[model samples]
Target: MTKRDIFISLALMCLWGFNFSAIKLGAMQTDPILLTALRFTFAVFPAIFFVRRPPEAIRYLIAYGIVFGLGVWGMMVWSINLGVSAGMAGLLMNMSIIPSLAIGYFLLKEHLTPYKILGAALAIAGLLASITITDGSVPLKALPLTLIAALSWSLMSFVVKQSKTKHVFAFSVWGMFFALFPLVLFVFIFNGTQPFIDLPSQLNSEVWFSILFQAYPTTLLGYWVWNRLTIKYPLSTMAPFTLLTPIFGLIGSIIFFHEDVSVLKLLAFALILSGLAISQWRPKKVEITSAKLKSECK
Candidate 1:
């Protein structure tokens, strides 16, 4: 990757990292579904003008949109509303890597190296340790919702891989539109007219700022830059940069929410980072004449 691409990738990670705090802030006043709805509503305008939809298989696109946009965000919003800490949520959501790998292996028939397996194990273990070591009691009620969010993301990743779509931002915009109805239904089923009608009219500046940041910076610009980078670089080269998101999330949590960091949590973070590194690490190559000959024949 070029230096500029690396910088863009880092910027994208930072944007995504700060999103946890943004979500947390928005949750303070806005109803979760309504907040999500408003986010998509804001996202649609720029997307409509700037992004051109890819002419690809409709099934994959619809599937990607539903899983990624509606399913993931719906569960995430509910989890946040049910009292899952944003920092913890961010950390746990990284668990999607496990499912993502599994999908690649089983669905796509991709080869999995020993290092990848070990890395996945370490990451899962670290996540478990983080949860066990928390000082405050975990909200069991929110656990299911959070897990659902992670699964939704995993599914979305696979769906995207399966999709014939060439334009990620365009697909994302359409996905948000697809999510609109389901999100409204979700809010209606859960909170009914009560939360919808009773939302605070005293909309603080912070809330609006949070919404705008999420829609424009995180969702729109972040994805745009990220998609461009992916197009320019190989997936293996680009994938490792995502590890930075959780790091950013942790820092953002500390700065914005004053989340306490215990030794155990730190250890867990280290283990997770180590696991991610292990998963991506390449072994030393030993060139062989026979291998070269076989490649030439193919």
Candidate 2:
């Protein structure tokens, strides 16, 4: 990656990191699923007006919408409302890489390198450590729910990869179009019309900030830049930078929500981040010659 690309990736990661705090903020005010619905609504309009639909089968788009919208994000916000702290939620959500790798290996027949295996081991260790934490951040239900969110993320990845759409952004927009109604339906069914009745009164500046920020920047612009980066760089080059999201997430939570940091939390952070980092790592290959002792591979 160029220095400019590096900088752009870092900036994007920062925005994504802070998104967890935003999710917490918005979900606190309204039904989590409804907030996600608003996010997709804004993300889809005007922008989706200009974007053409992807050529993938309708099933792929629908599946993409379902897993990406409700599975990954809807569940994530709900998990926060259930008692997972923003920082911890970010940390747990990042574990999607594990399930993603499993999908690639089992379904796509991708080979797993030793580093990735070891990295996964370390990450699982971090998760175990998280189980031992006494902080109220990780409630009994919160961990499982967040893990479901992560798994949904992996499924979303599968949908995207399986679709093999050159027009990724278009696919995302159209897919999310399918997701909006389902989300609203879920809100009405589970919570009743009361939240909807209260919707007008509930959408204060705090809620607006949270929703619009998530809609425009985090969902639309964030994915746009991310898709561009993935096209320009090797997946390995791009993947490690995502670790910054959780780090920034932790920082944002501390600043915005005063999330407590315990020793166990630190250990989990170290393990998970290290695993993700190592999973994406590739050692530089050195040239071997009988006559020449040393040569650098570029």
Candidate 3:
């Protein structure tokens, strides 16, 4: 990648990392479901005028929207509310990569190399270690909810991979539109009568700033840039950069939330990073040729 590409990747990582902090801020003042609904509502506004729908199967687009927007964000917000620290949430969410790879292998029939298998095992082990070190005492009873979020994300990845649409931003925008109704229902079911009617006014400037930051930079702009990057580069090349997001989340948490980072957690982080690197590392040219020949012969 060029220096410019590297800079863009770094900026993307920063945006995602800071997103945890933003979630924390939003959760403090508004109900999680309501907050999630509002975030998407904000995201959909600009796209209404600018983004065009792709000429593809409507089902794929709708499924993508549901999984990516409503399902993932719904569970994630609930998890954050339940007691998953923003930093921890960021770290644990990396677990979605496992399911994504699994889905690709089983459902999509994509190749899974030994390196990827080993990397996945190591990453999972690291996650287990983190859970154990934290005494499995997830706050707000958030583990299950977060796991749902992870699954949603994995499913969304599959949806994106299967989408016939070439325009990523358009898919993202349509996703927001599709998700709005479900998110509204969720908010109604959870928030009841005393909704975030006062949320706008009650939120201090810092919180509102966090909300707008999340809606625009993290949701809209970040997705736009990410879609472009994915189009320009191979998935393997782009996948590793995702690991950087959690690093930013950790740093941001320590700085903003004053979260503790124990030695074990640090060790877990190292193992996870190593696992991700190993998974994404390309094999030698000869090995690639051999694999290709073998597949063709089969």
Candidate 4:
């Protein structure tokens, strides 16, 4: 990767990292479900009017939207609001790679290497370590919800890989469109019209800034650039940069939320990252199925 590309990757990582702090700020002012709905609202409208829809099945688009938007993010924001620390949430979310790899093995018949198994074991052990952190700082109840979020993200990633969509950004936009309605319905069902009615008055500048930042920079810009990079470079070359996300996540949490970083938390972070690194290991001559297509730098 060129220095410019490296800079872009670092910027994307920072955006994602700070996103946890942004979500935490927004959660303070609005109901998590409602905040989620509003974020997608900005993600979908205006831009969707300009960006062409992806040439994929409507069912797939809807499924991606539901799984990625509702299942993953809804659960994530709720868990954070329920007291899951932003840094821990970011670290736990990385577990999505495990399920994604598993799905690839079962469905895509991708080679299930011994390294992956070892990595999975290490990750599980790390998860166990995370559970033992009974330091009253971490919320035990929110962990399951965050895990569910990661599981949903894994499923979403599988769908994206299977679709083999050429226009990833378009897919993201349309997916957000489809996701918006369900999120709206969720807000209505759970929080009802009261939050919506009071939303404008309730929102302070910081909360509004969080919502806008999440919608534009975090969702639209972040995914667009990320997908484009994946197209331009090999997954192996790009995937490692993602490891930086949790690191920045932890730093951002400490800076913004002043969250405590315990010893066990540090161990869990190290082990999980090590597992991710191991899982990403591929033979030098190995060809990735997804990279079969030639890259088109537009």
Candidate 5:
């Protein structure tokens, strides 16, 4: 990555890290599902008018939108509202790697290494530890809901790969159009006409700030740069940077929400990050040392 690109990636990570805080902010004001619906609504229009829809992606668009919007984000916002802290929500979302790897291995015939297996084990241990946290951060029901968010994230990844669309940014933006459907449907079913009827009153400055932040910088601009980076570089190079997200999440949570980080939580963070590091590990180019050169010389 160039210095410019590297800076951009770091910036995106920071925005994404604080994205949880933004979600919590809006979710506090209104039903999270409706908030998420509004998020995609703004994300799609105006921009979607300009970016051409991804070609031959109707089915893919539908599936991706629903999973990406409602399943991944809606559930996530709800989980946070249910009492899962922003820091924990960000960390838990990274667990999507587990399901993503599994889907690749079992369904897509991707190879899995022993390191990945060990890493999965460690991550699972960390997950178990996370659930056992009695610190009022991770509520019992919130655990399963966030797990669903993680799973949905992986499923959307699968949809993207399966579609094999070159226009990732357009696909994402257009797919988000579909995402609005499930989100709107759920919002209606759960809260009826009240939330939408009251929508006019809910558009305070703080709420608008949260919504625009999530929609523009966090979702549209963020994914656009990220997709460009992924296309320019191998997945291996891009993968490790995400490890910083949860770290940033924790830091942001402490600064904004003043969420306490306990000893056990630290252990869980260590185990989970360690596991991810191991799983995401790829072999580096072997530069022969003097000893290795001597053996070859011999």
Candidate 6:
């Protein structure tokens, strides 16, 4: 990768990192599920009409939509609303790698390496440490919800890998389009019609800004740039950069939300991140294909 590409990757990490604060801001004002609906609505509009549909079967697309949208993000936003700190949520969500590895081992007949087993153990320890928090900064109940988001994301990875979709961005747009309907249904079901009926009056510039940030920059641009980089670089080179996202997430949460980090939280962060690094480690001589990298981009 060029210096410029490295910079771009870091910048995207920051964009995604701060997105949690953005989601938190939006969730605090509007209904969480409704806020999610607004996000996918903006994500799908104009762009969805312009983008071509992916070559995958409609069932796969809809499955991607449901898992990506409601299963992953719906639970994430709701967990944040339940008082999980944005930084912690980001870290917890990355634990998806753990489940992905496990699922591959058991269901897909993949090998479970020693490094992966050790990594999983460390991450589990970190998760256990998280349960001790009583300061109310990180809600114990919300932790499980975030873990569910991680599992959903792992499932999404499988979905993307299973389907032979060549158009990454187009597939994502269509997935968002399908995701919008269920989200809207969730809003009406849980939140009632007034939020939607009064939507125009309810939206302020700050809220709109948050929604647009999450929709355009965080979701679309982030995925696009990351995918482009993955296409250009080796998977070994590009994949490691993603580990920085949760670091930036923690930083963003501290900077934007003034979140205080505890000693246990720091230990958990260290264990989880260290385990992630170990799991993602590749032998120095192995080369990976662009197709593999593309499939990994969700």
| Residue pairs that clash (backbone atoms under 3 angstroms), model 4 | none
Per-residue lDDT of candidate 1, residues 185-283 (tens digit): 878987898776776672588888877888898877776676566545433345446656767887888999888889888998888889877876656
Pairs in clash, predicted candidate 2: none
Task: Please report, as a residue range, the 10-residue window in candidate 1 with the lowest summed lDDT.
Answer: 231-240
Residue 222 C-alpha lDDT in model 5? 79
- 228-292 per-residue lDDT for model 5 (tens digits): 66556544345445655776788788888999988988888788778767765645533346558
Ranking by lDDT: 2, 5, 4, 3, 6, 1
> Could you tell me the lDDT of residue 129 within candidate 1?
90
Q: Report the CA-based lDDT of candidate 1 relative to the real structure.
A: 0.74
lDDT (Cα, 0-100) at 7 in candidate 3: 86
Each model's lDDT comes to 0.74, 0.80, 0.76, 0.78, 0.80, 0.76
Return the clash pairs for model 1, or none.
none
**Candidate 3 similarity to native, TM-score:** 0.88
For model 2 the TM-score comes to 0.88
TM-score quality measure for candidate 4: 0.84
Ten contiguous residues minimizing lDDT sum, candidate 4: 289-298
lDDT by residue for model 3 (74-108), tens: 88877887777777887777777777777767886
Cα error, candidate 1, residue 45 (Å): 2.0
Clashing pairs in 6: none
In model 1, which runs have C-alpha deviations exceeding 4 angstroms? Answer: 1-10, 200-202, 225-243, 286-298
Q: Could you tell me which 10 consecutive residues in candidate 2 have the lowest summed lDDT?
A: 286-295
Backbone steric clashes in candidate 1, count: 0
- Candidate 2: residue 82 Cα off by (Å): 1.9
**Residue 218 in model 2: lDDT:** 94
TM-score-better candidate, 1 vs 6: 1
